[model samples]
Target chain A: MSVSVRKTYKLYVGGKFPRSESGRVFQPAGNEAVNVARGSRKDLRDAIGAARKGLATWSGSAAYLRGQILYRIAEMLASRRDGMVQELRLGGLTPAAAQKELDNAIALTIWYAGLCDKALSLLGSQNAVQGPFFNFSTIEPTGVIGVIAPDKPALVGTLALLLPLLVGGNSVVALVSSHAPFAGLALGEVLAASDVPAGAVNLLSGHRDELAKEFAKHRDIDGLLVSGPPDAELTEAAADNVKRVRFCNLSSAAWSKVERLRSLSWVEPFVETKTLWHPVAP
Target chain B: MSGSLSPTEFRVPPVDAVALEARTADLATRSIKKDAKVQGLKLAIAMMDLTTLEGMDSPGKVRQLCQKAVAPLPARTDIPSCAAVCVYPDLVKIAAQAVAGSGVRVASVATGFPSGRTDRRTKLREVELAVRAGASEIDMVIDRGAFLSGRYGAVYDEVCAVKEACGDAHLKVILETGELKTYDNVRRASRIAILGGADFIKTSTGKVSPASTRPVALLMLETVRDHYLETGKMVGVKAAGGIRSAKDALRYLVLVAETCGDAWLSPEWFRFGASSLLNDVLMQLEKQRTGRYQRGTDFSTD
Candidate 1:
């Protein structure tokens, strides 16, 4: 006779697994209700703190190396495909839907991985001016990004929202879908096992409502990328810090446009463009 | 008379590290909110020694720091000016000039700060230079090498010399307890500095790791309490380094209040030697006032 091991879903902050500081756990819908970390505002704050520290190294890496790291994430997810399928099944998805979403997530990771180095040239510009000077514009990653993943297709939605932000070199503090957070937690495990640096992508498993206000108001977070309809209260709260807020409604039709999802426009909002003017030699 | 007690005469009873840690942990749980939280936040702000000690420090940076110390957030006049603007001896004149009428004192780090490796003559001269440059407070580092080698007398004598060199200027002796290794050494060193005429006993230079932990600070506070009981003199305690948030600062205040009683709660009795802590305190104050969270970018980074 053999015994099966059960996994405890915990918050991934600074690339380390930690139970919620509040010591509260919630059960997501599954055959067996697994205990997931019910993160608090303090947990979100800690994740932001970690992301801020991780941003320095992640944003400073060469674009090519970042691309390679994203590819490694795809490789890790592919290796864990069976586990992801099982997680999706437990969350009430059909086996076919589970396998499809897992495949889409891996493909999504690879899609963004290919754009890391190309984002700059495709988005940046060299300008012609009347003055005796040279002017050029280039994109730099926003320091830290806060993400709120959607409810359905947990694996693909979270990855679709997160990969674009990460490929642009911004570290993320994401609150996974409350209904199907196990997939996000599993992805976090894959991310940890992959070469993605600790703190580069901190995953918090909790209610979006509990963590959204903090995600908006945290001074350290530079931008917020939400994968649901735009929330008025969240936007208003984020206004206090002037955080850049962008929404991605990833519908089935939207997901079909893989090229559009992997475009420079997708990565542009998560980055700031700096235009430098230098004096020309006579 | 050297005005220094013989190191052999002062006795530091063995500290129960476990009990000290437990007490600190218990005090950390006491929550202050509303009016008390606001009052504690303001007190923490006033006790800050807005410090910038870096090799790359410039006149422009010192002037900006002094401006911050004086006005803090210009729009919020309710926020009190910090206790002092701490900098290198070389920047004392500029800092003094910047906060001339603002009541923010200029404190210069002297006596081979962060490391007391230089000779006594050079260290005393450094203090004299800062005093001449209009510094009202001197933050000096003790000779950890001497203290660790059982040369307690040498360490006490050096602190006394630095105090004499300070003249009217208040002396803040940085024990650099992170380098002191053990809690017993911290206790003994605190006793020696208090006996040697340190107006204030500081925990660290903010340059070393393991700077100013809670249990170590609690032990130092106990030493201060015992010293008062023994000698009838009240010495100040400044928990410097690693104290960033208003919550952490308030915990230190709570430690002081519970350990040394309410007398040590004032800026005159307790101080925080911090550089980036001011802005965070201001942000928290703003949140309390407006019931809204703030961003770091909104505050000026001097």
Candidate 2:
């Protein structure tokens, strides 16, 4: 007789999977043995800390390296297809719905993985200025970004918003859907398997309302991305740090409209333009 | 002259390692938030020994450090100046000159600091040099080689010699507790340093791993508290090295206030030997005022 190894989904912080520091856990589907870490504000704080530090290397590294790492994440996601689909199904999706969700998530990852190195050249500009001055503008990562992923299309919604941020070298701290946290928590496992640097992608499973305010208000978070409906309170809290706040449409139908969801605009919101002026001596 | 009373004269009580750790861990859970947090953080800044002990530290760098020590938050005038700016013997003059008339003392780490591997004559000379350079505080390391080899008297005499060499400067004896190996050793070293005229008993040299851990700081604090209770002498405790966060610094404050009462909360009685800790404290203070977490980029690197 073989005994299956049950999984205790935990928070992915700074590239390591740790049980909640508070030692709290909850069942998403009420499975007897399966428990997801109920992450706290402290966990979010730790994740943000890691993301801030990770932004230096994530953004500093050559674009080619980031693309290759994202490609690795895609490969890891494909390899872990069975587990992801299982998690999606566990979150009340039909088997076919779960498979489609997993497929869309992987496709989004692969799409952004290929576009990582091209973001700068596509968005940047070299300006023709007055004599003795050569001025040029380049696109830079928006630094640490906080993601509030939607409840519906849990896996796809997360990947749709998260993958684009990484393509531009933005380190992310994501608070996944509270209703269907299983798939998102499982994605942490896939991210861990990939060569994704610690802190580059931290995934926490908890209530969106509870963490959304803290995520938006965090001064270290340079940008805030919210999926589903716009939250006025979240937007107001984000003003405390003057964060670049962007809301995304992560509906099931929107996921099918690939052109809108997979465009440069998705990546544009999380990048800042840095223009530099240098003297050209004759 | 200070070593007349041998450290061995008093049988040093062995520390309860498990209990000590449990107590520190319990004390760390104290919820110091809101107004208490802002107040505690500013107090931490005030108790800070803004240190830059790198081999590459230049005169300009020391001057800049002194500048930061004097005005931690230049935009706001509410923040108090740091307790002192801790540097090496060579840079003491620049640091002293920069912090002069600013109420920020200049402390120099001397006597083969981080490693007490030099002779008595040379060690005392380094202390003398720093004092002559206008440093009001002298941080000297204890000879672990002597202390480990059961030469307590020699170590005691060395601290006394360095203390006398300090002249008017307060002598802070660094135990380099990471090298001490055990709680019993730390307790014994604390007693020896205090008896040998240590105005302060510091934890580590920043060169060693396991520098200034909570339990170690608590043990050292306990020794100081015991000494104060018995002899009515209030020797300061500077938990140097490895104390790089505002939260950890505040816990040291909590440890002091709990073990020795509120008397040790002031900069004169307690200090934190740290460099990066200052920015973290400033960030926290800003977070308190602005109601948002802070960014390291917003603050000055020094």
Candidate 3:
């Protein structure tokens, strides 16, 4: 691959970044000629398809690999802070606030990177019962995750939620903020630049609620990470297929990486509780 | 004048053939055909039984526990919020303020709860005071002497008076079934409360001998089913006392679902009068939908 080939870095669907089938484009960076691809219904369908395929592989991936990949992504993100800061400025953040936003983004990445391994350490334990057999339980990754990024820190909050689950070996299908698609595409470009697997992160940017209902209702999507107000309708819709719902109150004054992980912890539904019982052969 | 129901006034259901025939017919029509599923499992959770939580050395700690008890339920894929939080008449204000604007209702046990020994006028006054103090619901205990001694009229009249005194506030008439002594008394008391205009009939004040039991709950739900048929009002039912877990809440939901059908599924009609139970239900729901165990202290509404 040529270094300057400009990979177009379109919506990642089915392990590939393809231009939106809609042919619709928006000026995410507000620069002429360089239009950001707007995702379409087909792209969402393809994402659901990709998530269905990657769910088994990602969930079965070793937790150590998950943690290493996550840490690597955080390191890559740290190296690209200037580029992210510039993108934030272009997306309407003030210089001072952008600096703070950049800090929060980096902090969030590092924080979640550290948590990548600890989640299993904290959630798993050995159980001692009266039965003759040794009982062990470990927290497992939920299947595919659907994320609706926060509208304000579009990239940072998205990455905050995305990294934790991804590090825990969960594939994600993200519908990013409508107003801040540039930072999302930029991050996607960065993920592509890094060695993050093609199907590991599928990022779609565009429209406030274009695919939210579908995302919530998608049968293949096991868990939903929502970083906004509790949408009762969407929540009730998720109930159609019993999707695990994790809603983050972006309006709350207090939010941190721990809160993001705790919110995203709802992904445990896809974890299969395997009980090993060996009967004595008579 | 208020001690016990006169012996002459006590009416017994037919032990003879003619009365037995009518009873059997009534049982067949009601139990087998229409309301066949009415079975009760206790669901009410009494808030702090504290007549004075302020007297405790650590009111702040108690207050924190109470707040923890009333924490917002975690999102659940199945079932719904069980019941309103029941507090003392004094703490009704705190509870109302604590859960202000929250979907959970504030219920204060009033009208001489548990004993119901206060005068009728004072009882009505207690009801009025609680409602004015911001209690969305009131759980008033019935006078067991009048109920047991077969002074049905007096028992019925007192409940009606308390319900009227409640004004717009929903009145939950606690039968103190533990003191009522038998399933028959529990059934009759439930009937009397419903006939007397109870919006919801609860099990006990959690201050009696055997607060709330499955058998008692079953009898009451049966009465509620009959009452609903006789009068189309469709009053709510609450099984208070000893309910303190998510599984407990679900059992109550199963009871309500089995007995009252899906209409009573809303928190409006069915409630678990629990203090520590809400958190468990929330944790279970969180675990069921999210797969993590969150302690009651860890999740806070305020």
Candidate 4:
């Protein structure tokens, strides 16, 4: 006799798979076969803590090392492409659509990987100042970020928002769309194997509206990406902490161009521009 | 100044390490959530002994710590102040002045602190100095070397001397459980300290790895309980060092209630000797109140 083992769709926080601390799981729609972790605010807090620790090592890492890690994520995704496609299909995606989503996600990863090393020179510049000083502008990752991942085309949608931030060295605590979390959670497995530092990317499967306000109100989430329909509540909460909130259109349809997703617009919002002033050496 | 009875004369039962560990492990699984969780976190906050015992400690740091102990979350008046602010003997005066009007007491560690390597005379003098300097509670370390060498009488006498020198202040004897290395030794030292008149029995100095563990704390609690049953006197238990989370603190509260009954549940009878545990408890309380998780930047740091 053979015993079959089932996969558990748990939250990926701090590079580890843990069921919700609340011990609650929910069935999405009519799918009895899928029970996703109904992440609570406590779970979100833990993800932020892990992301903060990951930020230390990730942001401190050499830009070249970060590039290598992003490339590794792309490599792992390519190897697991078929499995991911099948996983996405479980979310009601057609065979061809699932394949395209995985391919675009992989391609997007590669695009951002190349952008990592060239980020400084390409995004920063030297400026002329009136005084005897060289004024220069540079870029840095904006610490830990919370992303409201787009609901449709889950994998590619999350990566579109995630890759640019990671390329800039910001660790993420993302809340994947509750409707289709299987593929997004599966991506966590790919990132884990890809050598993205433990907490560099965290994913939670739960109601976005419930967690989005929490993401904005959280004092440590230095930046947030609200991906879908505009929420006035999240906007009000982010104002309390002066948290930098960026809204992006990540509907699956928008991701078809792929080129638009690869631009500086995504990377610009997640980076801080620091201006430096130095007297010219005598 | 040796104990009244010979060390071998006391018929203290040998601790069953596995059973002790299993009991404490069972306590760890109990779920204390929502309203009860809020109560426990507040209790954990009140039972905390905010400690800063570094060689580089300054008057400013001690005063700042005292301020936090007084008003952990300045915005919330409902939160109770910590039980005490623990520091070295030299800084007790500063802590006492800082927490003067506040109900928070000043506790100073004497008897050479983490390592009880000093002579008995110097140790007693240190305790006296701390008591004279206005520390309401004195945390003294036992001569672990004497306890380990089978010189139980010497260890017993040192505790007695320190307790005497402490005068009106309560004396909490530190076993430095990490160095004790065994459940049996922890129990024996606890018994020795209790027999010699300790107001409280603490686990570690917060300087050693494995400073406090569940099994060790359970063993100490059992010793205290058994003594209270034998005699009517009750002694407090402080699980110090390495306990950093609100969850871990709640499990400890459960252990105390299970082993020693609800009477030991108060900060007067039990304490957590930790430096970083206060903020985590505050954050948990805030999470309970606001339904949103907290970040470190929102709270003041030590």
Which one is best on TM-score? 4
Interface RMSD of each: 2.6, 0.7, 12.4, 1.7
Query: Model 4: which docking level applies?
Result: medium
In terms of lDDT, the poorest run of 10 residues in model 3 chain A is: A255-264
Ranking of candidates on TM-score, top first: 4, 1, 2, 3
- Please give the lDDT score at residue B72 for candidate 4: 92
Give the per-residue lDDT of model 2 (tens digit) for B197-288: 99999999998998889999999999999999999999999988888788988888889889999988899899999999999999989978
What is residue A98's positional error in candidate 2, in angstroms? 1.3
TM-score of each: 0.93, 0.92, 0.44, 0.93
Candidate 3 residue-wise lDDT at B225: 71
Candidate 3, pairs of clashing residues: B44-B239, B44-B240, B44-B273, B45-B273, B45-B274, B46-B273
What range of 10 consecutive residues in model 1 chain B has the weakest lDDT sum?
B1-10
Q: In candidate 1, what are the lDDT values of residues B1-302, reduced to their tens digit?
A: 33256656656788888898999999999989989999999999899999999999999999999999998999989999999999999999999999999989999999988898999999999999999999999999999988888888888898888999999999999999899988888999998889889999999999999999989888998999998997889999989999888899889999999999999999899999898889889988997897656667789998
Per-model chain B TM-scores are 0.97, 0.97, 0.74, 0.98
Clashes of 1: 0
**Chain A only: TM-score of every candidate?**
0.95, 0.94, 0.84, 0.96
lDDT of 2 by residue, A60-109 (tens): 88899888988888888888888888988888889998887777777777
Task: Evaluate residue A116 in candidate 4 and report its C-alpha lDDT on the 0 to 100 scale.
Answer: 92
Q: Which residues of candidate 3, in runs, are more than 4 Å off?
A: A1-9, A28-34, A255-273, A277-282, B1-302
Candidates 2 and 3, the one with greater TM-score? 2
DockQ of each: 0.52, 0.80, 0.01, 0.59
